[model samples]
Target: MSQAAYIRDMMSDPASDLATGPSEVSSFYSNLNVLLTGGNGFLGRLLIERILRSCSGVNTLFLLLRAKKGKSSEDRFEELFDDVIFDRLKREKPGFAQKVRLIEGDVGQIGLGLAPEQRELLRATNVVIHGAATVRFDETLRTATNINVRGTKEMLRLAKEMPNLKAFVHISTAYSNCVREFIDEKFYPPPIDSDKLLNLVEILDDAPLQHLTPVLLGKYPNTYAFSKAVAEDVIRRNDHRLPVCVVRPSIVIATSKEPVAGWINNVYGATGIVVGAAVGLLRTLHCDPDMIADLIPADYVINNVIVAAWDLAEARNSNINNADSSKNPEIDEPPIYNVVSSCQKPITWGKFMQQIEDFGLQIPSMLCIWYYCFKLNKYEWVHKMYAIFLHLLPALIVDSVARIVGREPMLWKAYKKIHKFSAVISYFATQQWRFNNNGVLRLSAKLSPADQNQFELNMDKFSWSEYNYHFIRGLRVYIVKDPLHTGPKAVVRYARLRLAHYTLISVLCGIIFWLLWTLVRFMGI
Candidate 1:
């Protein structure tokens, strides 16, 4: 169907929009002036598109963007419209772009570095959605803290200044406090105080800080998780009077079922592993097959965020007049929703891996034969040995060649850098953490059946076999792109190489058997 037709179908029924969930209070859609941070990112882009098409009565959407290399915030907003993700919006309403206004600022700076006009836009905003954060797992502590922790602090401070702000939603990760095996719906502060860590980071130089990050993070997997955990604590402590909600989503993957099924834009999460395995780059994963793989789609996450915001706003408003009652209304705290899939449906790592291998082989290309053979016969020890040899021996050989050629050996250094980066992420892939998602289930149950169908987060609805097909398709169309469509070419090259390799091995085996027979005959046995 054309983009216009799709938009009409979605907007024709307001109840079908995933964002329009069941709420206790009526008329929650009136006069919503939303200020969304990270509006240029993948999830942010989808959220904005959904809101514009579904929520027609929204007053305005103020996008918080930082100035890029040579482009101003206005220039960036214009460029964002050119992306295909917004094609649906462009078709639905030619002037839909008018509702979105860009506010130039830096999240790391105070008041988000907004000027007078930008602050004016923020102050008038009714809802604030903070989605901007450094997602890099191996990012430096200084940079991560600056963007993740301090940036959130600045946004919260700005929210405090907004007189009409009804709800402030902070996007966080389910693995923020992943060091613990069982995570419940409660705030667990980090071992070290957030303010003290921020202070130490502010005074120390980059070199010394990088050296101390390992010791500082301690039991935490990486700096990303550590910083995000600290950021959540900061939000909880800062939101004493205002209504705030924290959404902690598990390892976010592609869209399960939405405007487009299995739609993914980035290759950072489990999608990366699937892509690597499809191309024969990843062979043996050090993980249990039975471990639960907690992955929630980006659109589903945004849906929950909107619902949580509305719920928090209503909850806060209800608590306002009851301050003098015997119940002590001040004790009513903000709810921290764990938006995960453990309760609804849990997928096993082994099943996911098997499906990816099958789907990669089914794609129409010359690569299919090799991928098929790799999955059937050569995927055991041979592929693992080959990976180790290619990853390790090349650097050693290159360094030797470089020494002979009278040049510095840089290949080994580059390999070390990549190895270090992979090591940090491998921990999560090799282990599993249990996040109790009773709160998400309870909240979801409160929604109407139509709302449940619109915002589908239940794992029982996902078919691993079908999803795997779209997963590969999404990788080709989005992650790898058209220019890199070399699956057919790779299949041919690997097939010929494998043929030569097996022939040589067979001939050597025959010669060894013949030699053993001759020795037995000569010994007159």
Candidate 2:
């Protein structure tokens, strides 16, 4: 179907273009100004596309962007459309750029680095979506505090200044409170006071702060989780007179539907493991095979975000209209929605690995240098043994050959980076978290059938097997830059690689058996 036809089918009733009513979520956003941060990030880009394509009545979208790599925000904004992710949006609404207004600013800076005029313009904003944060797991404590903690505080401060503000959605990770095994739809006590920690980072130098990171992180696994937890506390401690709520989505992956199926941009978190394994680099991972792999697609998260903002606005309107009605104590607190899959549709790491093997082999990438095989080791020692033999030894041999051929030796360095990534992700992979998503489910239940069809969050009917197939195919096509047309050639290459791999393994086993037999003969057995 054409992009225009797809939008018509998804957004409105097939009978007419005027099927959208005032009660619909799209109507709720009609003529409302929206302020969005982190418009260039993975989820951020999808959110922008969804809002523009679905919520067509939005007046103006103010994007807060920072200059990076010597490129101005304007340059970045124009270049954003250059990405194929926007191809569908561009075709659906070629005039979408007219509704977007760029604001040059940085979230990490004071007052969100907004100019006086920019602040004045944002006063008309009705919706604020704060999605900016330093996502690096190993980010320095100071930097993480500045972006995740302090930046969130600044956003809340700015939201208070908007007289017409209806909803403020702060995007966070589900692992923010991984220190606890069970997480509910409410706030927990932060590791440290947001103010005190921010002050310490501000007062100390880089060297001393580096030394203090571990102590400051406390029970948290890394700065990303630690700082995000504090940022939640920042929201809870504030007098939230505005319609503000927090959304915590677990390990976001590719787009399962909308815009395009299996579309992904970056290789973060579990995506790295998928790409590495698909290309025949990653052979082993230190993880529990039975542990729940709580992964949600990007479209699901964005859909939840849009619906959550609408829900918040509706609740606020209800409370105002029925002042004499008794208030639910739950509404007084900032609502937290843990948008995760394990609570509803659970898939194990073993099943996840099997899916990768199934789909990755079917549509193998031409970039594959070896056979597709992986081991999920429950013990760290076993994982290390496999890594040394399967990862390090092969990398060393490859680099040595490259050096002899007068080419730049890079395989060893690449393996070193891969090892670092695996170590950072080991904490989450080895354990499971039980998330209570009653709030998320309740919110979905509130939507009408039409609205639910437009903004899907219910995972009971979701298909992981189908999603996994598209996910592996996406990694090969999008992330690995291998086109789908090359699948036939790739399959031929993969078969040869698989044969060579088993032959080498059989030869090694035979040699080891002969050695054992010779030792026994030497001992006069």
Candidate 3:
């Protein structure tokens, strides 16, 4: 009933004062110090921005970054300002950047590669958000295991050291357990023991390890999901000392709201498919029309991450005061939240395709290659045939023309990459997964009313139609980085392409008809 009783018996954390109001939540974050991993990533950036913007009381954001591309972490931190996503923060609070401090460390390393002093400083952190991982589907087993699995292990090690740590939000994917059709808000056994895998990887050479990958993965799709699953198992087995929570978000796409609508950085996950089809590069995809497109806005996922941390913190604080461990033994197991849309705001692949087609016409890509046309089918064989006629053949013809003109033949390469992308993504597109999100809903209910509004993870409140429109527009601007002014030109180009396509079809049909007439005459029937 009331928030106080709900917290004590329900979550077993006696310190939850959130039953009182949003002020308590705010007061909790005020003057708090956070240790954040993967601060340079798309989701990481959103998390940092939300924390600074939502909780003004948050004092310091200590980012864990290693030297990348010959640049120090501090140098890369300066480059964050150049990103359009942070423009709002810069304009609103000129000194907002002051709150973020950099810690030089590599998660792939033992002990997180942090200096003794740096580790000591992190010991005072209030919360640790570990979101760093190698997300590539085709990544080598060694690289994937090192970054995704070993990296998480290091985060747990660091998290255990934080004396004031209230919660450790370990970001994972809903697809980690995709081997099954139904995934509940709980940890399933990993494919292999984390430590054993680590030791095995270290003992075997690169060639042997790569060869054994297929055997190691077994029913798993790729090393990314395989390693992430193992990483979760690692956290599950060793999460006793810290207040750990696993957040599994399914198919995260562009931002629906906040800072900017339709904001995205990379052409990964569903964004690649959406952008490729909208630009007329992708023609056909093998997907069951009825399969749920469990896509969530990046900002929505970020909201859940922030609120989850606060929820766990308030609960932990409440526990320290009253020490009611007997109330809920279920608390002995780590809390798992599945942040997915299928259970709340389900969008079928058929609906998503129509949305893309509709918005695609309105927001044509600035440099459409064909005419922004595509199709989706449930049959895998048909998809393969379409890939040949609609994809490979066309790519060959285009590349041949480029070769004749002495220009670089690139279309074939692009199509090859597209084929690989489709092959990998089709696993989810062609299948159905029923993820239960009752835990996520329960987590949201625990947030303060004010926090609930500011940190918006309510899927019931999400508008699929409206968000999909902005999502397409976001691909136009952010993913492709195209200027809005060029949309009109793209529209005209699309019109011309359509005319040429029709004319070519007419000529080919006439040629076929003439050949049939000649064949009949020769038969003399």
Candidate 4:
């Protein structure tokens, strides 16, 4: 049965037991103090917004932010609230911003760059949410290791100093163990000893390290995944015995419903492609149309994160109470939850593309360069040919015309960059992943009814059509920064571009046919 149908059946069947729900989950965070890293990031911002708006029992969120652009971390904290996300909070939950306090620090630094007083203050934190890491797939091994591997080690060290630390929720990716086809909610052995790799990365120079990268990343696809896999190992291998749980969420998109329905702030991950395609710049993608697009909403991910923190903390408390009477100590292991859509409402790439295209036509972007039409091809060579003929050829012509007319030539550069980026992401798009999210379902079932509704993470109840429509609208408004009033102009431009595309194809075919006929007559064959 489809996950959606299974969930529906579970909800309707009164005969089945739902008593595994969280008996004491609801008010676990009353007067709870939190120490959160990655305050200025995309997910960081959403998590903060959700906590302030929804997690009412929470006391304060002490964010660790690095000072940048000559601004103090405290000064830069103001910039975070200036986002449209906080706009809703500022009006509806007027004083919720008061719950947030910024501490000057960098995860990459010694002791997380925390000052003595800051460290002392953070010692009072009962819960630690480690959401900080460089998530780019193409990041260097040295860089990814420092932040993902070493940084996590530093956070665990800091967690030890926290006299009251109950739960440590580390944000990981579902693809960390992606080398395997069917991933269970368990940690695989590290590819290499993390400590050895860390030392080697520190000692090796740049050029040599670059040369050694492929050798180091053997079975792993990229440095990001390798580092994350090793980071998970770091946590699993930790001797600190601290309460820990890793939340692995897949392809996080805009909010389905939360601070605002379909609210997105950045153009990272799939957001770039969504916005790029909506603005009519992206035309072809090298991806399998049948592969499952394991997308989970940012808000849903956040909701699960919050509840997971509560549940994990409760489990640790139970362990403490049963410490003396322990039945084999229950594996001293931190539970991992795979927050993905595949185990729930699985949507194929073909369906996802159709939804995006349908909505793109309905709510056209003002900044569109062409019609919102795109092809998803499984063949890499076909995509390459399309890139050359359809993408670069037109781009070169446009850029050449601009150069001739004394305008800054840019279209060719844009296409080159676009194709390069498409190449980078195509690896994942063509591959199918079957993530086992039994852990996620078990987590949800563990939640009390009231807590379940308040912090719902179930994708079975989600409607994709409505979500896609609002998401495109949100992309237009928030990410594209385009006005709704410009829709009419965008539609006209789409029509013009479509006409130009057809005319160009016709002209090229006619020229080829004419040349062939002339050659045949000249030969007298």
State which candidate has the highest lDDT: 2
Tens digits of per-residue lDDT, candidate 1, 150-172, equal 99988888888889888888999
Per-residue CA lDDT of candidate 2, range 1-525, in tens? 333333233332322323443337888888999999999999989889989988888999989999999999999998988877687677777899999999998889888898999999899999999999999998999889998999999999999999989999999989999999999988999999999998998899999999988998888989999999999998887775677899999999898876667778998989998888888899999999999999998888998889889889888778778875356554678788999999889999899989888877778878997897789999999999999878887787678889899999998998899999999878889999999999889988998776777777889989999888778866766789877778788889889999988986686567669999999999999
- Candidate 1 residue 384 Cα shift, in angstroms, is 7.9
Weakest ten-residue segment in model 3 by summed lDDT: 6-15
When summed lDDT is taken over every stretch of 10 residues in candidate 4, the lowest stretch is 8-17
**lDDT computed for candidate 3:** 0.82
Number of colliding residue pairs in each model: 0, 0, 6, 1
lDDT of 1: 0.71
The list of candidate 1 runs beyond 4 A from truth reads: 1-27, 69-71, 321-331, 364-386, 393-421, 483-525
Residue-wise C-alpha lDDT for candidate 4, range 250-313, written one tens digit per residue: 8889887666666787776677777777776787889899998888888888887888888877
In model 2, the runs with Cα more than 4 Å from the true position are 1-23, 503-525
Alpha-carbon local distance difference test for all models? 0.71, 0.86, 0.82, 0.80
The top-ranked prediction according to TM-score is: 2
Candidate 3 lDDT over residue span 1-525, tens digit each: 222232122221212323435654556678989888998999999888777866758989999998889998889887876877776666555787778888999888888889999999888898889999989999999989888999999888887777778889999999999999999999999999999999988999998998899999999999999999999998898754688888999999988776577788998888898889877789899888898999988888897787778788766767667667657544567778899998888999999989878877986765777766588879999998888767877678778889999999998899989999988999989888898888789877876676666666778988889888777776776677666667678788788988876775576567669989999999995
Taking all chains together, each candidate's TM-score versus the true structure is 0.82, 0.93, 0.92, 0.91
